[model samples]
Target chain A: MTTPAMMYVHDWRAWQPGRRDTSQPRLSVAEKPAGGHVPAMLRRRLTGIGRALCDMLAELDVDADCPLLYASRHGDGERTLEMLDSLAEEAPLSPARFGLSVHNAIPGVYSIGRGNRRTQQAIAASGDEFAALLVEARGYLAQGEPAVIVAFAEQAIPARFTAHFTTPVDTAAVALRVSLTPAQDAWALTPRPLTSDDTAESRPQPSDLIDWLCGIRDELHCHRPRQAWSLVRAE
Target chain B: MTSELEQELKHLIIDTLELEDVTPEDIDPDEPLFVEGLGLDSIDALELGLALQKRYGIKLEADSDETRHHFRNLRTLAALVEERRTA
Candidate 1:
């Protein structure tokens, strides 16, 4: 019997900084005005960085109908900072802010916006967020449901917390749309580290891996950030 | 002329609202308090109202149309607080 199919992919920066490939550019925070088509209530508190990620997923055709697995290394750092700052000053926390400060808020918002009721898994690991998510997606694939995995990582944090970890200069979001089809481009499930290096010697970062899969680039070098994850056909 | 009342009000706004990007001086007395102004939402109104009652010993009548008028802006909120403080 053929092994079940599992795919891993990534999308970095929703909107392009300049004219580039087919990857759609991300929208600015200011662009997300009140009552926009994007489920405004669910996303009002998201920072520009967070909103950029949601926009990227929406652009990639991630709808509520699809099963999704969302993984984030450091989820909602800005909200965490705000809450901690208020608590430190002996100020009453804003209820709205407190509600959205949870680690699952990113996936929660995306699910609500897309009206997706499918099972969604949200996880935050010390450094194995990507690996953990890939394993989860494999589980779904084994269960016989096509899985769409979105893995995102953002390094923007308050300096108080930044001093503890390696400072990430940029942010990224990557998504993959995976399904079983009669094609040879299926991705094999493998456990590995989340690396920033894109060299062939080093395993490709999620973003570079998707780029290579899409044939956008032959290879990506080290230092390129990896973002969201998804499944795509190998051409 | 920073009266104790004004200072109290400023402290209340800063503390109750959790306005991180805002300081007491940054809030203009006449600025609209919601939407185009400080961008406070409906949830903020509820929490601020609760704080006002507990901290200032003022019972803001929920049904009164005056409640909306009183919460229109900081100046109005301050006026209500001043009126209640004296009474």
Candidate 2:
């Protein structure tokens, strides 16, 4: 018999920087990353998204070597825009800019800076990326990994592409330390395949995870379009 | 005239590249900008190019092989800007 998926969300943190207003479509991030907690060499090289990701990673309670998975709907939109601008202007693209424009750039920098050689994944999905991350985290728990960290950071779409999205996105990141061992007040997550009846209203927000982390919500049912993932408070 | 442009170039490099720890006086006029001397990489070079274009109204040819030679050091960069400045 196969062991059922059992995982405990040990700790989580949320950091949202920049103006809350989504009308202004410019890239804004925290002026300083974790108040310089990140090493200067790495910090200097990091883009705004990378800095935000590192800041969220610093707030995580997990070990430095823990496996990490990062998810986002739009990862490094500013850098990507800059690359496009360079291309349009017929300018040579900088090697460093191209390197940081990749979706996995933040995790790769974190791995190298902390000397972590474990496996890491960068995920990008159309909608409800946070839900996808939770589902992925549960899968990791099923494989007997002691713990995993899922960090997500994304910003508002650039002004050029604002027409493409209906929801006003903001610059935010959430880091969850999902563990195998259940502790007091841990939320147990069980994911089931979704049916047609389950709609978009059940979709999870970044704030929902924050509410669960802060003990405000007893349970959270994070849903994707066709995924019926649910989290319940362990009794 | 050359020394003044070189000094101005040094300050521009420090400001535009965000070399927080280094000062204008710290960068040598003849030191290589990449790999060994000032430790700037290709991104810095691109940013510096843009800044120079904005400040000095200079045009940089991306396909020109001589562009790399101009970016070799602060002195070379200042000379190129001086020679090419339209405004």
Candidate 1 lDDT, tens digit per residue, A39-91?
54345556554565566556555555666677666777767888898899987
lDDT string for model 2 (A47-122, tens) is 6656766756655733577789898878888789889998999976755667677889889888776677887999
Interface RMSD of each: 5.3, 3.6
DockQ of 2: 0.23
- For candidate 2, chain B by itself scores a TM value of 0.89
Q: For each candidate, what TM-score against the reference?
A: 0.58, 0.73
Please, what are the lDDT tens digits per residue for candidate 1 over residues B21-60? 5777876767787675767767667767778877777777
Clashing pairs in 2: none
**Candidate 1, residue A82: lDDT:** 81
Best by DockQ: 2
